[model samples]
Target chain A: MSNEETAGSKPSEKVIELRLPSRLGYERVAMDAASSLARRMGFEGDRIAALKTAVSEAVTNAIEHGNQHNETMKVVVLLTVRDDELIVSVTDQGSKSIDEAYVSRVPNISEAMQKDDKGGWGIWLIRELMDEVEFTKAPGGGNQVRMVIHLER
Target chain B: MTTTRQHIIEISFPSEFGYEVIAREAIATFARCVGFDRDRIDDLKTAVSEACINAIEHGNKKVHGLTIDIVGVYDGNMLQIDIADQGIQQYQVAGAPATIEEKIAGKAPARGMGLLLMTQLADEAHFLPDTNGTRGNRFRLIWRERVETLEPEH
Candidate 1:
């Protein structure tokens, strides 16, 4: 079972895609799917947990910010497993420009806590847990946040 | 596609995790009507979920009988969503750990990520406190359709 053939367009890669309604209930579905994929990629313990958290945050962001809790909207999650890396991309139909969504620096924790601020931490966790994070405008005007976890690390 | 008239939808529901689906689905439908593609729609879904969940879990703390109000507006190529929760507790913002070692310490709670996801997923995300005591915590998310030049008709 460990040596099962990889699936997808490329022989060495496997891809799993899901289109879910923009609902918090569906977040669990994405998280579970991501956890299973991470496990299949031989991730253990903390790495698997990290992957799950990252995926949850990403999907949650999509359903919340991208779709604005609009039921008619759909959140698409794509998981690609390659020999060296696991890449997950969560795309939403939001019109936010990529330049606007990108955060250049990690927020300072003490300052944020001092103000009693009540939000602004999901992207940082995604950056910390994943090896590489990219935000781009998806085809047809929405945004896509792509996170990659290197298997060897 | 562009429209001269603006469309607005408003809904209020209890601050429970279950009701978050209603908000997400409504926003998504509006986004689709505004002509957002699959990828953009997904982004809207995640961002809205983060905002709504934060309001339910943290802002209202799942307090019984509390409500979260959602307003979605679509104008031309722009979509705006506002989620407001009754102010029960002060919002707690999560800051980044100073050191990578501290970040890896595994002691930090996962609550802080909601705000970060909001800013990253939406074009503009803002948190407004109800200083006047009328509204609660108001989280606003805005996305604008990029104007693409069409190829000249041959």
Candidate 2:
């Protein structure tokens, strides 16, 4: 595809669908989609970069911790722009419980904790970068992490 | 005899976002001193920002009257940044077996993805628990030579 051809391409008014494989290499693909959506929504510079960082962090969570890099599973990123707010919903097929209290609480101990961290830290970063973050489950079944960042006017 | 021209900057902030800003300025200074390219400097800034933000938000989380220290070193070609915060050590987020989407859908919970981004952002990233057991967190960001000139533009 030519650069002009691609640049002229517009973000679909409908939900932009992306099927990211459950692998480490597909991270860039996901980041591109998220950043493209952010720019199209008129997010400039730092705000755009912030959106990319948040999106990448969320997708990385989906791949490494969520899907456990399961080959059979797939990650779906859905983008929707509402006014000055950009809403991103990333869904993946994994079975686990969503604990809001656990995700938000600050860790209070590390004496017995190993220096080499085994797991933990993605969601906290997301909350820090985005204006608002929430974890909501669909009635049908699946995990949905909704992240919203309000673009500056 | 072999010598590497590495410059170090120490910035101390008291519960302020200045920690992040100073870290960035230190990076720009180190990059110019080391003669790194524009693109490379930008990359270093992004990676450094992520690390500094992590330390301020996670390490200093609401703790007042604490200082965050950042040191930038330019080894002729490579750039190394060390940022420290004296706060209780904890994984900002937990790693879950389910993806973030799944967690948001209430099917599962999201876990430690921040560390992953930090690792990917920089060439080398590692966290060291305070060896003195004072609850200090030290995070490092390292990258290779990015350019061949070290001149500042006026």
Candidate 3:
């Protein structure tokens, strides 16, 4: 599942790229790919599950919101493994600026859940699970959500 | 009650995680047709997906032979989506931690995030019991278009 741009790239820094159709069925594909990469990096049990959930939430947001399930649109995920951290970035074809809508800080889960609100948890979960979460405009266009997880070794 | 400004699209599919894409696509398309901006459409799609996922996983408990029914109603500049599952169980909805101290000490619960996402993405999101007293859980998501002006008047 890992994509190596350079066959002999440094072991500590390798990048994996995945392109998937902006469809819900493909979400599982992204999750599996992320999980496999995380597992290969020595993440176990709860950490692996957290990575999978975080990737799933990011891909789900890209497909359901950013790409709007348009067949022509694609969700691009890049996983970069560093010596001490893993960085995952999800890019979608939508041009809307998420800066205004995105809440920079962790939401008050206790208060939010009590209101029985139906939405706004995906980003929160991503932020909570990953060591660092960021939103930025993609290179060619569209939006990108980048998340980082610190390695335990 | 029907009005000239109302356009309704209803779909029924097995209660499965895979079918959530269909519901998301349907709502996105409908929102686009109603002249909503790209940002607004994306918000609606996110909200719809959260609701649909909740229905499939929590409402139906991923049970076989059950179905999730979704209805999208576009009334003028506002769009409302209703996702229903044929399950009688109710979920406990609690509020997020009120202070930074509480959040730092609290662990995020997996089960409740979907509902929280739905409310944040949509303008309004709430649950309603089956009007006819049927055995099901219904979630409603609403999004309204922001009014825009062409130019400042002299």
**Candidate 3, residues B43-132: lDDT per residue as tens digits?**
787778788878878888877556678777776778888888887466524454134343455755434556666777888888875677
lDDT of 1 by residue, B32-129 (tens): 75678888889899999888888988788877556677777777778988888887865744343134344357665543666666777789888765
Worst 10 residues of 3 chain B by lDDT: B92-101
Q: Tell me which of candidates 2 and 3 scores higher on TM-score.
A: 3
Per-prediction DockQ comes to 0.01, 0.01, 0.02
**Between the candidate structures 1 and 2, which one is better when assessed by lDDT?**
1
lDDT of each: 0.72, 0.63, 0.71
Worst 10 residues of 1 chain B by lDDT: B94-103
* TM-score of every candidate's chain A: 0.87, 0.79, 0.84
User: What is the TM-score of each predicted model, taking all chains together?
Assistant: 0.47, 0.43, 0.45
Candidate 2 lDDT tens digits, B52-89: 77776788784644556666665566778887887755
Model 1, span A16-118: residue lDDT tens:
5556667665666567656765765678779989988888888888877888877667677777767878888889887755445445567778888888664
Docking class of 3: incorrect
Weakest 10 consecutive residues of candidate 3 chain A by summed lDDT: A1-10
Q: Give residue A55's lDDT in candidate 2 (0 to 100).
A: 81
What lDDT score goes with residue B136 in model 1?
A: 71
DockQ score, prediction 3: 0.02
